[model samples]
Structure formats: structure tokens, C-alpha cells
Target: MLVSLIFKRTYRPNVNTIQWNKTIQNHQSNGNYQQALKLFQLGIEKNTFQPNSVTYLTILDICKELKSLPTVRKIHHLIDESKNLNNDDIQNNPRIRSLLMDVYIKCQDIDSAYKIFQSMNERNLIDYCAIMTGFNHQKQYEKTFELSKQIPASIKYSSPVLCTLILQACIELNKYDDGYKIHQYGKKFLPNNKIFMNELLNFYLKFHQEKQALDIFDKYQNQQTIIDYSLLMKYYNRQYQPDKTIELCYRLKNHSHIQIDHIIYVLVLQAIANGCCLHTSEQIYNQIKKSQTHMDINNALINMYGKLGNLDQAEKIFNSMSKHNIVSYNILLNLYGLYYQSDKALKTYHQMCQHGHQPDDKTYVLLLHTLSQTPNKINDVKRIFSTIEEHKRGPMVTAAMIAALIRAQLFDEVNDLLKKLPKENILFYAMKANSNETNEKFHYPISITNEQLALYDLLMSNIYTYAGLHDRLTNVDEILYENKILKDRLSYSWFERSNGKIEYFKSEQLQLKTCEHTEKLALINALDEQKNSSSPILIGKNHRTCTECHDYFKKVSLSSSQKKVYLRDSTRFHIFSNGTCSCEISS
Candidate 1:
């Protein structure tokens, strides 16, 4: 009797169209989308009730949620069949067609979505948004721009959604001029809208217009979010304004409403690392330890300690981590390389392999770098270079190998390797080597930027001066002047004092009087600022310290002041005291 009752309930008939639609709507409202879809299909198959426009719309909504492309297509076919019977007309129902386009886009069938969009005789704002957003998501930035041109001017200026989409396209296409105009439009029209305001902030940040970004941030203080603060902090860090980054972090920390997260902590740590303030870094580290524990934060801590020349602390953090990933191992390997610990780096590489982590291209490059530091490890460098797959040897890997060979004074092998590389790669190598011979011999098909040409000229001049080729150096200087590239890419250095004040000096600023190198100017300024303090002065440079600068630092270490100095360059740290440098081989 129970089985019979269940069968009767399952096969109950006489359900009208209104009852079927209500049941589907009920299931949909309750978030039972699959059940809603099944009921609709059962109602259609059983012919208990005729499916109406409402039923079709609800089913399409379900398909959109499920991302069910096959089911959507089947329903579209049924709609077409119904049109033939004059029951439902798709042409008259733009709402249904727009929904259909949205479903197709959500299903990842952009071609079908575009077809439906094209079939719309009178497209609304919704239609344009659905299609353009789809194009943008698919990375068809050009198509998005083309559609923007067709947007009716009446709605184009008023729709925040359209403005945001166009701004995103402008960013991807690098259309700075258009992006600026859009920023002005957003300011004039949609100033108070949070969505558009956030996008505008992003636009300014992308173009590196810090003043403009700050203006927007200030104007939208009430609407500001953690993401905005994070983005601004990241921008400052990228621009090497670590002090500004830390200052902003302090502001965010003091905000009474918003709470800091792990990402913000990582950015704060990164800023401290760049600033090279061991005290501030330690303070932040202690605060982080008391509050939370995250892998990214720990990794960033390791990097911070590494930059401050505290390898033992970096190692302690690494040992404390319960799990390790490729990034963790890479950071440790990089730290070892930075300190020229080739043996330890090699042991760590073996351990990484044993733990089933395959070494990537960066691993091989780091290994080569560490091995190149010691003259006796030339053979190890060659062995490691051979193990790297040919396809994986990109421009950076090849350049690293060439650098290693040059450091070992293997000029013949360097020349042979240069011969085997493609012309483009050879040009890249020439730029790094600053070889005038290579520049004059090969005519590359690619056109390098003016900035790159200026850098090439500067490095070549340096090479000429080092070799005592006065005539060649003079000729390069003439070219540099003719190109008006003076001081465009000149190096600068800065140091933080004990009282947390930062002193910056540019190489160009001191060219007229006392110092020619950035590090020298920075050192003089640091000594003047911290005359009473005998602690080691840590200075960070934007470029590598030349041999002249290195020797000068060594001499300064033995002078009357007897000041110990730590100068961090593009690659590693150089600690000078008592007329000795930490680097085994001077540049």
C-alpha cells in the first residue's frame, strides 16, 4: 500500500500551468535551481501544462546559474520552434533575448552571444553591457573599444558601468590619453559613485600619476576601502618610496573602522625591507608574531631579514615553517646566492629535489649565480647549465650563463655561446656586456627603445673608461649628449638615520662638486647626518657599485672617522670595515 501511494503521488496529474509555474518559482526562490529545472522539464514532457514566457525565463535563469550550455541551446531551439507556431515572438521580446545573450556569455559561448546581440534590432543599455563585458572578459579589448564607439551618447556619458568598462579597456590598450579624459569625465559626472570612483583611482595609479591618485583618494575618503589603501601602498613601494608606503600603513592602522589583513601586513613588511631599517622591520615582525601567522607574511619576513643581511634570522623563520612550497625554497636559495654561499645553496637544491619539488628555470638561474661567485665552481656552473633544457633557456637564463662564463674569464666559451644564440638574444647579451664590438657587428631586426639605447651608451662609456680607451669614451659621451640623455637614468642612493629620517642623494646632484657616484654622495650625506652616532651606516643604491666606489669605501673605512658602512647595490650587500669588503671578488 505504501509503494502504491508513492507511485500515485509521483505520477499525479491534473497540474495546471499556474500550479507548475508557481512550483518552479518556489524552487528557484529557495535556491533549488536543479530541482526547479527538473520540474520544468517534467512539466513539458508530461504535457500536463503548457510552458509560458515566465516558465522559459525562469528556466533560462536556472541555465545561466548552472552554466549549462547544452540545455540553453535546446531551450533556444524550442523558442525558435514556438515562434514558428506564432506562440512566442523573440523579436518582440527583447528582455528574453537579452537574458539569452547573458546565459550564452556565462556559458562561455561568446560566438552565440554575439549572434544574439547582432540580432537585436533595438539594443538597450543592458544589451551593450552584457556583450561588452563578455568581450572584455575574453580579452578582446579592441572589440570592447569598437563597441564603445557605438554606445548612444545619451547613455554613454551617464552609465557608470559603461565608463568602468571603457576605463578597463583603456588600461589594457595603454591608451593613457583616453584614460585621462575618462578620469575627467568620471570626476565631472560620476564623482560620488563608489564604483566609478574606485575605477578612477585605479586608472590614475596605473599611469603612475601619484598626485592624481591621492587627490581621488582624498576626495573619496568616506568611500575608501582596504583595496584602495593596499593598491596605493603597492604603488609607493614600486616607485621606491618606502617611507611613504610605511606612512600610509600607519594611517591605515590608525583608522578606527577598517581592519588590516595579511596582504597589508606583507606590503608593510616589503616596504620596511626596501627602506632597510632593521629596527622598524623587527618591530613590525614582533607585532605580526603576536597577532597572526601566515605563510606569505613569513616568506616576506624572510626576505626582509635577508635584505637586512641577517641570514640566521631568515633561516630561523624558514625552519619554523611547517610546510614549504616552491616560492619558499626559491627565497632561501636566493638568500644563499646573495651571500655567496654556494655549498649551502647546492645542498638546499638537493633537498628540494628529494622533497619532490622539481627545479624550475629560476632555480637553475640562482644556482648558476651562486656557483659563479667562486672561481673554483666554474665546472659546477657548466654542469648545471648543461642540465637545463634547451627550450627552458630563455633570454634571462642564457644571459646568466654568459655572465657566469665572463666572471670565470672564459672569454672563448662566452664567444661560442654568443654565436649559438639568436640575433635578438645576442642583442640582449650585448646590452648587458656593454660590448661596442657586438653592437657594431650585428644589425638586429627589432628596434630597441630610446631608454635602452641610452643605457647601452652609458654602460659602454663605463667600459671604455675602465679600459682606458679615452677616445672611445669621448665618442660615447658625445652620443649621450646629442641624445639629451644626461641624468635621465642616473643612479641615486638613500639611507635611513637612527632617528628614522631618510637622506637621499642623486648622482647628478653631486657631479658638479665632490662626488661622481651615487653611493659616494649618499655616504657623505649619511656621515654628516649621523656624525655623533658610530653605528654602521646602511646605504641602498639604485645601481651596482663600481670598483672605484668600492675601493673608496674601503679607504673611508680606514680613515679617521673609522666608520663601518653597508652599501646594498642592485645585486648584493657590501660590508666594509677596517679596509676590507665582504665581497670575495671586487667588481
Candidate 2:
């Protein structure tokens, strides 16, 4: 009798909604969000007879999945029209409010989400917790605290969602004191919500507050699902606590709901790779294949072999993939480039493009970087640059190309490259975030000269040294410390180098000032004069080369600034001030 009823929950009497739900689930699982959304709407319109919050939440789920604000508002209105929200079974509609709030949060419509929270005047702690979770989702930590104040004291603070929000926000902002206070508050409501307890443990472990983190882990770690264990183990691997990571995985093996995922398996493999235990990672990967889950663990294998510098094994594993993804190509391209195998890198690029996979920004950046390593390969950089377009460029690519141009001392070309960019400088952008600096854009082409091509190689070497790219930094540093002239040229263009070294140009000489008799008269018609005096910054196509005067500016610049200041040869005017710069390059 129980078995019959257990099966009945999934049996939809309305055959249309059932079929649509299956399609919706399939589309969602594949991350084809738009298809999922349309199918949900069709189901709702065609079968309003089976309307419930589950049906509405299905619509909301599609909104969250698609991240479509306009559709989400329309779905909310549909729910209002259905008035199933007025049903006595509000208790069964566990996720309707939460999912709606989630959609609003994803849309960044925080005000709309808050308004919904305001209308829920019955003020169940779950509702309060959901609102706090919504605020946290929006990364509005201050708002999370502000709303927490409104909850009545009769309601407990350790509501599953509130504790989780506080834990997440504290870590995000690095506010240890606030984390501690909420953590202390959390133990009271710990009897229910095992998920919250695991979250707290994860936060503690994140801060390396291990004593408390593990103690909590020991008390309720068994209560967690596979996700918590995998997360805990991943954190442990990061913290170099391999023993604990293994222990958690072992404990998780018994939980019926927990099973191996590619990510967790990858984490364990990483620990093996780090400890020089390639055999162990391989053993784990082999075991993972037997779990009845379809996952390509080839990337993990490649990464392991990569660490050992065993290109043969890495390549063997890469070739074994039935269908290669962008990540697989990127990893191999990087390895070949790392060895300065320029011919190999170019060939790989051809293979990738031939396979109908357009190379992302990193692919182009990697090629340019390898080209920067050798003078012979300089043409490759020029060819690649000419293939790019401004709109497709990103900060990392722009910065890399800018440094490359500067290294070639194509002083006049910097303006063209920069005008294509959105920022005043790439350094300012890198400061705001890590590797959000995507160079995946494959557009933004530019023409490059032989001199500019040579410069790309030199600048990339400097960048590699600074980033400590290889097994040793000296491969780059030796080149840097040796090239004092290059260093000086770079410095004059910017501020003082970090090393605070200065060197005067060898060709430094004074020049005789020649004044045109009509110079003052020209200024009287200054706007007209300005048209003729537009800087050398124009693209080469716009102006013919003035070969006779090319060498004359250095002398003029030296005499004008009492040094080799930018005004003489520089394109953009730099008005130098006390010991610093304003648009500090050159005029």
C-alpha cells in the first residue's frame, strides 16, 4: 500500500504538464535555460488545472535559471492571477517564496525582493531567514544585518538561512568578529538544519580556525550529504590537511545520498599531484570511472602529468578524449608555449581553428606570449595583432599588447592601442579583481610593424619574470636585470621603476631652436593650426612618414625639458609636475 502511494506523487494526472515537466527537467539539467522557460510557460497555460506553488515555482525556477528579469515579473503576476497563493496549503509551498526571492536577487532587483518580504507579515522565521538569504545573495551584507534587527527576539537567531548568510558574508568581507558573534548565536538553533552546521564549519576552516572547525565537523559532519564532505575535503586539500580530507571522504562513503563527483575526485587528485603522488591520483581516477557516472576525468589526468613535466603522458591523455573541449586545447597550448615551442603552438592554433572552435582570448594571448620569447617569431605577433579588433579586446589582452608595443619602443603606436581600450590603464583594472581579466575575446585586430613585433617578445619576458611564471623567476629576471636601457626607457614612460633606477639616453644631445616667422600668426588661427599639428599618434595610414625629422625630436625633447621629457617625440602631451607625472608618458 505504501509503495503504491510512493509512486503516485510523481504520476501527473494532467499528461501535458507531466510531459512538459520532464522536458523542463531535461532542459534545466543540460543548462539550456531559454528552452526550459518556454516549456514551463506552455505547461502553465495548457494545464492551469494542476496549478500549485510547485507549478509557479517551476516558472520561477526557469526565471532564476535564465536570469531573465522581465519573464520573472510576468511569472509573479501570473501567480497573483492564479491566487493559489491564497490556498490553505501554504505549509506545502516550502520553496515558492525562496525561489521568487532568488529570481529577484539574481536580477539584482533587491527592492522587489524586499517588497515581497514586507508583504509576508505573518513573519515566520523561515520567511525571515529567506529574506536574509536573499540580501546575502545580493551581497548586501549591511542589509542582511539591518533586516536581522527587525526579527522578534521570540524567534531564534540560528534559523538555518540566517546563520548561513552571516557565515558567507563574514568570509566575503573578512569580518572575523561578526562571524564569531553569529557562530556563537548559531549553536542554539543547531538541533535542526544540519546544512547550516556544515556551513559554519566550512567558514571556520576557511579562516584556519581549525580547532573549532574540526570540533564542529566531528560533532555533526556525519549529518552532511556528499556535497558537504566534498567541500570539506576540498578545503582540507587547500589547507594541506590531507589526512582530514581522506577521513571525511571515507565517512561520506557510507551516506546513501552522497556519491563521488568529478570535482571532489579532482581535489583528491590535486593533493596527490602536490605531494608528488601521481600513482595515487591515477588510482582514484580509475575508481571514479566505476561509479556509473559519466565524467571526463582526462583533464585531471592531464593536470597531474603536467605537474611532473611529462608532456608525453599529458598528450597521451589529451588525445584519449573522444571530444575535446576548449579547456583541453588551452592546457596543451599553454604547455607547448611554456617550452617555447613556437612552431608547435602555432600548429595547435591551426588545428583548433580548423576544428571549428574559435580560439578564445587566452588562446591568442598565449600565442602572442610565446612569440614574445624569440626575435625570429616576432612576425607571429604582428600577424596575430593584425588579426585582432578593438571591440573584442579585454584588459589582460590590452595590457599584454600595450607592454609588448612599449618594449618595441613604438612610442607613437601606444595611442592607437589605448584608444581602443575602455580604461586609462590596465593596472587599475587588475587591482579590482583577480583574473576576471579575461582575454577570451577573439576579435580586436590591429596591424603591427616589425619593430612592434620584436617589442612583444621582450615585454612578455619582463611580464613572465614579474609574475614568477616558470619553475624559477631568474629565467625572466636575468634578462630584466641585464637590460638596464630597456628598464630606463620603460621608466621614463611611466613613473620611476620599482627598483628606483635611472639611466640617461646615450643619444642625448641639445638641438638648436628654429622658430618659424609665422608661428605667432599661426596661433591666431589656432584651431586651424591644431588640425595641422595633430600629434604623431595618428595611425600610419592617416599620415605619410616624415623620415627627415624622425631623429630630430630626441634632441628637441632633451633641450626642452632639461631631460628627455615626452613633449619632443611623445604623442600624448605629459605635463610633468613635482617628482611625479600627469598623463606621464609623453606629449
**Highest lDDT: which candidate?**
1
| Candidate achieving the largest TM-score | 1
TM-score for each model: 0.81, 0.54
Instruction: Find the 10 residues in a row with the least total lDDT in model 1.
Output: 2-11
Q: Write the per-residue lDDT of candidate 1 for residues 370-443, one digit (tens) a residue.
A: 77777788998898889888887865567677667766768789777776666565335444335455434333
Candidate 1 residues lying further than 4 Å off, grouped into runs, are: 1-51, 68-82, 89-92, 188-191, 353-361, 376-389, 409-490, 509-515, 558-564, 585-587
How does candidate 2 fare on TM-score?
Answer: 0.54
- Cα displacement (Å) at residue 110, model 1: 3.3
Q: Per-residue lDDT of 1-587 in model 2, one digit per residue for the tens?
A: 22222222332345455556666778877888788776665544444334455556666777776788888887776554444334533323546766677678778898898887776546676667666776776678887766656767567463667667767777776778878887787777664677777778778876878888767766764465565666677777654444456555555666776676777666665554433342244456567768643224676667656543456888898877777777777777766654455677788788888888887877776677655555566667777877877678765566556665544555467557666656433232322222345533222122222222223333444444346442222222223223443322222211111121111222121221221112122112222322343221100010111222222333333433442222211111222223333222211
Q: How far does residue 484 in candidate 1 sit from its true spot (Å)?
A: 9.6
lDDT of 1 at 244: 84
What lDDT is obtained when candidate 1 is compared to the true structure?
A: 0.73
